[model samples]
Every structure is written in C-alpha cells, then in structure tokens.
Target: MHSIHSTDAESAQNLTRYLADEEETLKFGKKLAACLHSGLIIHLFGNLGAGKTTLTRGILHGLGYSHIVKSPTYNLVEIYKISGLYLYHFDFYRFNDYSEWEEAGFRDYFNSDSICLVEWPEKAGNLLPKADLQCFLNMFDSGRNIEIRSSTETGKQCLIHWNTEKNI
Candidate 1:
C-alpha cells in the first residue's frame, strides 16, 4: 500500500514496502523477479504464514512459470529453469544443525549460473552463503510489511530497478 526508499551507499540501499493484500504482494514480487540475475543469493526472512512462499510464487510467475509453485518445505529445494536462468529455491526450516547444511552440500548449487532464494537461512547459521539481497517480512493488519536490503552491488542494482519501476 505504501513504499519508502532510501540509499545506504552508492551500491547499497534499503526499501520498505507495505503490501495491503496478496495481489499487491504478488505484484511486488513480479517486479523483483525482473531484477533478478544469476549468481545472486537472496535470503528471505519471515515467520510462518508471512507470505514468503506467495511472493516466491509471484516471482516464478513473473519469470514465466505456469506450473505449480509449491514451497520446498518437504523437498528442501526446488529447481526452476526459465530463459537460461537456473533458480534454486531452498527452505532450511527443517535444519536441526549447521552440519545438516554441510552434509546436504547445498553450497554447490550456488554457482555462477544459479540464482538462489533461501528461506529460513538462520537455521543454517553461517554455513549458508552471504546474500546479495536480504528480505525481511512481518505481519501487518492489512497484509505484510516487508523490507529489502541490498548487501552487494548486484543487489543494489536490483533495488534500483525496483525503485525505478515503482516510480514509473
């Protein structure tokens, strides 16, 4: 329902947006999807029922995916290929220890040609790769309050695109 943007540095920034409903959340996610590129690591922060998966579904929709976009809660990871982009959606909610991540060998998937979207990364401690963009979501009376922080130049570029798109 509202957007507030600010820059932290030349190549780092933060933005907060209020999503009044699921439709708005999806729309925002689509915009984010357009800014995604390979080799980007994105960490999503939110509680259960906080709309993380819905936003992920929206991103997949924006990327031209028509099939089901289900959370990888059970599978641990879901792979999607679209227009030469390899997206790896990961959920570490089930992780009981940092060793679980190392044992699973999930780091191998975060390669040059892969764009990783990780949820519940806190469960993995520092074992997970650093995120280019960090997204935090909280529940709001109307819907969700979300914040996107750019930690790398690559992430800043995406936020810049997202800001510009919102203005337009």
Candidate 2:
C-alpha cells in the first residue's frame, strides 16, 4: 500500500496515478463497490475523456450488473438494480440550469435505499445532496490520475479499507 500525508488542502491536491489496465481498474472499482452502503453519494470530477464512465463501468461490473453501462449524459440518470441495491448513475453534462435538478425531483433519489454516482455534479449547485466520496480523475499522457477524497467519516473508513485491501 502507498501512503502519503499532506498538511494542507493544496498539498493534498498533488495527484496520484494508477496505471490500471481495464482489469485492474475494474478490480479497484469492485473493491470499492463492495464497501459501499446505501445513501452513499459519490461525486466524480473530471474533464472530458478522463475515464469517469470507465470507472463507473467498473463499479457496475463489481456490483454484479452485467448489462452494458452507458453514460447518463442525456437521460440525466440511469437506474440499476443489483443484488437489492439501487444504484443511480447520474450525468449532468448536458444540464443547462440548476433548476432542472429540482424540477426533476432528483433530491428524492438520495434516500437511504439508493447509492448515487454523479458526474458533473457542479451543474447541480447546492441542490444535490452531500457526497460521501469525491473522486477526481485527470488525464495524463499515458494513463489516468485518480484521487479519492473522503467527504464524510464513512468515506474515510471506506478509503482506509481500500488502502488496506489493495495495498495502495
């Protein structure tokens, strides 16, 4: 496992890279999915082609969802039922106004029975629920950089578990 401690937010922002071939990335996502609980919100931040969807695909695969996973950019949300878990994958890329979040009544989806993974969450402003984990993805020349930050105590525990399990 790799461990680095930053004294400040800026230092914490220094990126880390994982050259996870598809298999490894899937494995990582699966590991993360296993630790998830309902009502968890994962905020994904990345520019175009940063592999957010790829990571989400991994998560779905890990959750035992065999169907094809596609970005919900146009549809706004995709609901998946897997092993009694309601996983909502949301992509707000096409969102033009924050009011749409309210108009769509998306806040109701943040209940204790569902897990939400939101891409382009910035588009929702304060309407969206608080995220448990914030995952930042960045594009490098050859691979991707992934940084996971815990927004809540549960998220911190999840990261600690992942670090231990994956020896990251």
Candidate 3:
C-alpha cells in the first residue's frame, strides 16, 4: 500500500491510498479498525467486486472476529459483536426504494452503542442518517484506489487517531 495524499482541515480530513492487491486492502482495513469507535457511521462507495467485503473482513479480523464475514447483499444487514461493540454491516445494493429502509427497521441499529458501516448507501436515498466517514474505492488496471474522508468531528478524530497509530 502507498499513501497518495493526506490532508487535515478544520472540519474535514482526507486520506488517500493505493492498494496494490487484495492483501494490501485487507491490511488497510485492519489498520482502520484500530481507530474505530462506537456510534460511528461509515459509508462505503464502490462497484461490484471492488473488495468492500474483503476490507470489512479485515476489520472484523482486527477486532477479533474469527468467523466468516460475507457481504449482506440479500440479508441487507449483518450484526457482529466484537469486544463489546455492536458492529452493523449493511448493504443496500438490492434496495429499490427508501421505504425498504424504513420497513426493515434498521433505523434503530444506528445508535450510540453501535457502529454502522453501510455499503451502497446511495440506494437508500435520504432515509439513512448522515455518515461520519465516507470511503470510496475505485478500481484501476493493477489495483484499487481508496479515498477516506471525514465529514464529521467524530470522524476527524478517528482519522487523526489512525494517522498517529499507523505511524507506529
């Protein structure tokens, strides 16, 4: 993995990196996991087969989850309890309308005691709450380019923590 850019502003912070392969992506995810906290909401943007699930798997692994981690495409969401934190992984790729989000009763999942990570969040429209952090993955000829941005103060703190922890 290569650091492309990193910037810190008053309200928003951005970090960009290049993942040369699947292993690097997972490693990056693991690094990100170390900086996660409860009540955080993250939006993941990527195309199909963009290694989103793989990255989440690495996060789970970093958080001491030993079982399988799969994309919640059909199930919409998967709940995992790791180190006393409730991590909700949601995929709205199959969503056709905003009502589906309301009907699923997922609003309650984004609480102060839990962390929410959503994929295909755009499909749900404005039903979901604003994400603290947004991660975008774009595919290139040899690998993937990941850009992580913090849209909230809490997210900025996490990014700052990640920057500090990653250097060591």
Candidate 4:
C-alpha cells in the first residue's frame, strides 16, 4: 500500500470581500454565521486589533446571543450555549508553550455538536485540530479586507449554502 499526502485543493477555494466599516464586517459575519454548522472548526487569522473579536461578536449576535460579547484573551475560552448549539470562542494569544493547550483540558471541547472559533490558533501549535474554514482579516485604509477559505468537505458544503443565500 502506498500512503499519499494530498491537499484538499477544492477546500482551498477562497472567497474575498471588502468591508467598508465595522457595520459591514458585522453584516458579513451575520451572513457567514448562518452558514456554520456543528462540529466545525473555524480559524481566525489576523494580527491584534484586526477585528477578530468584533467579527466574533457579530457571529454571536447572529446566533441569537443577546448579551455582551467580549474577547476571551484573559479567560482563554468563552463558552456560549444558545439555541441548542455550543460555541467555544478560544483565544491563544497568551500561550507560551504548546503543551499548555493540552494541559488546559481544552481538547474535550472540540467534540461533535459544538462549534469552535479560534483566534491566534498558531499559538496552540499542532495541538489544535484541523480547521474546516480559515478566515483571514486584514486592516485596510477604509476598513478591513477579509478572506474565507474552506478546508473540509463540510466547509465546502456550508459555503455552497452560503452562496445560495447571499447570491455570491
């Protein structure tokens, strides 16, 4: 038997959009949030102050969370259980060691029927799970430039549904 390593090129397909302001970013998140499903891991790639938390807030708002949405920088992870869905918002910016992720007993959170949105995933090293979607956001002169990439079959299907709704 031959073992092969192949990348999911189909999942590599990406969608790019421009947000002219914070509202647009929130709108985009609202639209994107509806596309997400259970057991999906979304990786947020951006530097500090790049609006990761702001986008997450929009996603939470779209998911029917009426309370305040804040970054879990100090808390490491914020647990949001609403409308029969469990959303784990994790921030690993403060992580100094890879083993710290394992030590934190966070692995159990990635089970089925849960959605994980991770910021600063790189800080977790290989301890993190493979992302179904990778969302990259960059600050721009007007607002932010955002790119979304699907990296799993489930993610691709989700994007298809998002496209059907957004006419993208």
RMSD of each: 1.9, 3.1, 1.9, 6.6
Lowest lDDT 10-mer window, candidate 2? 8-17
TM-score of each: 0.92, 0.87, 0.93, 0.91
Instruction: Pick the TM-score winner.
Output: 3
Look at candidate 3 and give me any clashing residue pairs: none
Evaluated at residue 77, the lDDT of candidate 2 is: 96
Of the pair 2 and 4, which is ahead by lDDT?
A: 4
Q: Which ten contiguous residues of candidate 3 have the minimum total lDDT?
A: 3-12
* lDDT preference between candidates 3 and 4, better one: 3
- Residue-pair clashes per candidate: 0, 3, 0, 0
Which candidate ranks first by lDDT, i.e. highest? 3
In angstroms, the error of model 2 at 19 is 2.9
**Which has the better lDDT: candidate 1, or candidate 2?**
1
lDDT tens per residue, model 2, 124-163: 9988888888989877786766778888776777666665
lDDT of 3 at 150: 90
Candidate 2 structure, TM-score to reference: 0.87
Whose lDDT is higher: candidate 2's or candidate 3's?
Answer: 3
What TM-score does structure 4 among the candidates reach? 0.91
1-114 in candidate 3: lDDT tens per residue? 545454345323777788888998889888899899899999999999888888888888888899999889999999999979999999999998889999999999999999
